[model samples]
Structure formats: structure tokens, C-alpha cells
Target: MRHPTPDPPAPGQESVWDYPRPPRVEASDESVEVWVGGVRVASSTRTLRVLETSHPPTYYLPVDDVVPGALRPVDGATWCEFKGEAAYFDLVGGGTSAPRAAWSYPRPSRGFERLVGHVAVMPGAVDRCTVDGEVVVPQAGGFYGGWVTSRVVGPFKGEPGTWGW
Candidate 1:
């Protein structure tokens, strides 16, 4: 069964990027961008992820953030105990060597219902992540979250369950 957006760790929620993440909610009408291979792929003001590990919030850029035209559907899909089924994408129009460099869930489980339609591209797959034309420096593991250059909390996971992201 799904739980309510795990209330952010409370005011004293200790870690990094100190702040109550409120609750993983729906992406607003606004949109964020994800650029891989130095090319903008998609943009969507969608739901992002907030963890206690050691980094900043992971913004799940909506499929709208992606150029759509630049992505080619791939046969890669993964399931998460918390999130849901993820669909993969191939960076088709950019100089990136990755045929399938990003993934998302159009329909996510209730636990991760907020992530539906948002896309998170592998940071290692991109040169840099820029929000509103400003490049965002990653925290530790290079997982892009559109978080502007600043004090990051910790390292996010690259592959699922690898680092317990």
C-alpha cells in the first residue's frame, strides 16, 4: 500500500539542504529543463524527490522539459519498490552517445504518483544541468536535480538500489 507523501523529515530534519520538503506533490504548470549532451531535451514543472542521504532534492523534470522530438523510446523499464514502472528514452537528436539515457513513469504507483510524467536524466549522461540557462553544479555523484550551484546535502544514487538513493 502507498503512504502519504512522507511528510518531510520535520523542521529539524537533519542532513543537508536543510528544509522541510513539504511533501512530494504534483508538478505545477511550470516546468524545469533537462539537458543532456549539452542539448535541452525536456521541461516540466513536475514532482521531484527529497532524500535524507546527503544531497539536494532530485527534481523529476516532466517529459515536457524534454524536447520530445529529441528522445527516442527504448525498451528499458525498471520497477521500484517505492516508485513504479519506469520507461526509458534514447537521446536521439543530441551529440550524446547514449541511445537511451533517460527514463520516467507516465503512470506511477501511488507512493510515487507525483513523479508521473517527469523525467530524470542520468547526470553522468550529461555535461551539465542548467535551470533557466544557469548551470547547476551537482552535489557528489553527479545526479542532476536542477539545483543551482551551492551547498549540496549529499550524494544521490546513479543506478537504483546501488547507493540506496
Candidate 2:
């Protein structure tokens, strides 16, 4: 299924339609925080976000900014045509765990080399994920890792009928 044309962007907002097809990665200085099981497992001022057409941005936190021992590698891998292979991780902190709640592309594709070793979490798998102090909503599908912030306007991809969009 496919979604209709994207909505227009209001002032101070960005339309997902303007994002790239192959995707682009940009460094972000905004504060991105992840809390799981009642504990802050990751907080970073330096992060990377991938912008792709029809999808909300996917923020990638450097491993250094994440709590030590907070991520445990899990068994399983997925491939992204644009980002290369991704490995999954469990968010293990505060005596709680969310399996395959995070992922990283150890050896990202050429254009996405900066993502190597940087982890992007599934917002739905954590208690909450915040960007610039605003709590984020997870992109609708369980498979995509995009984090939905108010700054982005979408009829975003990841919904039931948007898989082919």
C-alpha cells in the first residue's frame, strides 16, 4: 500500500516529503535522551539523525554517550539497502531489559559511515525517548526505528498501509 502525498510543513516544521530517497545523515547537537526501566540509559548532546523520505528521523546515539554496559548485543541482524547490515541489542539497565530494543550498523554503507557503532533505539521499546526536551512518539511500525518529534510533520511512513510508500 502507499500513502497519499505528504502534508505541507507549517512554520518551524519540516515535511518528511522533503527528505531524501537514499537517506542522509546529519549531526545533531540537540539533547537526545533515552530512559528505560525507570533509568536514563542514554543521553547525548552529539547525535546523528537519518532523514529519509516519508519517514520520521532516526536518531543515532554514540556508544560513548550511552551508559556503560547498558547495551547487550543480541542475536540477529537486519539489512538496510542504504545503511548496510545492522545488529540488534537489548537495553539492559536498572534491573530491566528490553530485547532487541536497539540497533547499530557496525560497518555502515559508504554514505552512512558515521553511523558505525552508533546505536539507535526503538522508542516504543523504552519508557520514553526525548529530543530537545520533548517526549517523542515512535514511528508506527514495530520495524522502523524513527522517532517522531513535533518538529516533524508526517503522514509518516511505518503505518499499516505505508509499507510500500
Candidate 3:
């Protein structure tokens, strides 16, 4: 499948095309929060984000800000060439449960060491997720944890026939 042309970024917005192919992880100062089943499950002012081509940024929260007993380690692992092995975690707390709703890299690759032990939740798995007060739109196709916000412009990946890109 051919890569579709991406939309031009609007003023004050970011174009996913401009994101790097190898992906980059950086500390994010924006406030990131998550709610599930009417309860606040995670809130963090010190989050990190992973940015990659054709994908929205995936925010990772420090384990300290996530409510205790909310994440339960589960079986299964996925590999990312740039980030290394990722382990899944179920979000369970506050009368709600989302299986395999979060993931972390217990031993991230060299450049991604900051992500070790940090959790990045699937926005679709929670009732709501926000970055800097803007509600997050889950990246298309359940596989990627990227969060779309008004500040981003994309002809994103994860849709039908776009995988080979």
C-alpha cells in the first residue's frame, strides 16, 4: 500500500509527517490524566512522550502518579525495534477493569531508557484521557497507544492497508 499524502499542519499544530522514523522519547511537561469508571486513575505533570512518523504522541506517566493497585502485570510481550520488549498490564481499580490496557518497557533500549518502568495507557481503554486539558483521541486501530489531539494533523497509520508503510 502506498503512503497517503499527509495534510499540512495548521498554525500551532504539528504534522505527524515531521515526526521521526526511528521515534524519539522526550520529557513532557504537560499535565496528563486518566479516568476510568468515574474515578481518577492516573494524574501526572511529569510525563514522557514518544513521537514517531505518522503517529500521534504516546504519553507515558511516572509510576508514582498512577494510583496504587491500578496496574497489574500480565503475560505477553511485544517488540519495538527502537524501544525493545514491552510488557502488558491490566488497569484494575475503582470499580473498573481494562484488560491489557497499559504497557511498559521494563528494560528499554539504550536511547529509550527513560521509559523503563513507566506506563503508557491505551486511551480507548479508559473512560477518558487528557493531555494538557485536551481530551485524547485514541490512535486508529487498537494496536498503537498514540493519542490524537487538536494540535496534531495526520493521515495516520494503523488503518486498513496502511500497515506496510
Residue-level lDDT of model 3, residues 4-47, one tens digit each, is 89899879999988999899888988999988878889999999
* lDDT measured at residue 76 in model 3 versus the true structure, 0 to 100: 96
Best by lDDT: 2
lDDT of each: 0.54, 0.93, 0.90
TM-score of 1: 0.61
lDDT of 3 at 149: 95
Q: Which lDDT tens digits does candidate 2 get at residues 34-126?
A: 998899999999999999998999999999999999999999999999999999999987899989999999998898999986999999999
Pitting candidate 1 against candidate 2, the one with the higher TM-score is 2
If scored against the real structure, what TM-score would every candidate get? 0.61, 0.97, 0.96
> Candidate 1: where are CA atoms >4 Å away?
1-31, 43-52, 95-97, 132-134, 137-148, 155-165
Best by TM-score: 2
Compared with the true structure, what per-residue lDDT tens digits does model 1 show for residues 1-165?
221222234443333434333334434343456666666666555446534333455556656656747767889688755467878877644566455567777788776676766676665466656544556655444443325333343333332443542
Off by over 4 Å in 2: 1-3
Steric collisions counted per model: 14, 0, 0
Better of 2 and 3 by lDDT: 2
Better model by lDDT, 1 or 3?
A: 3
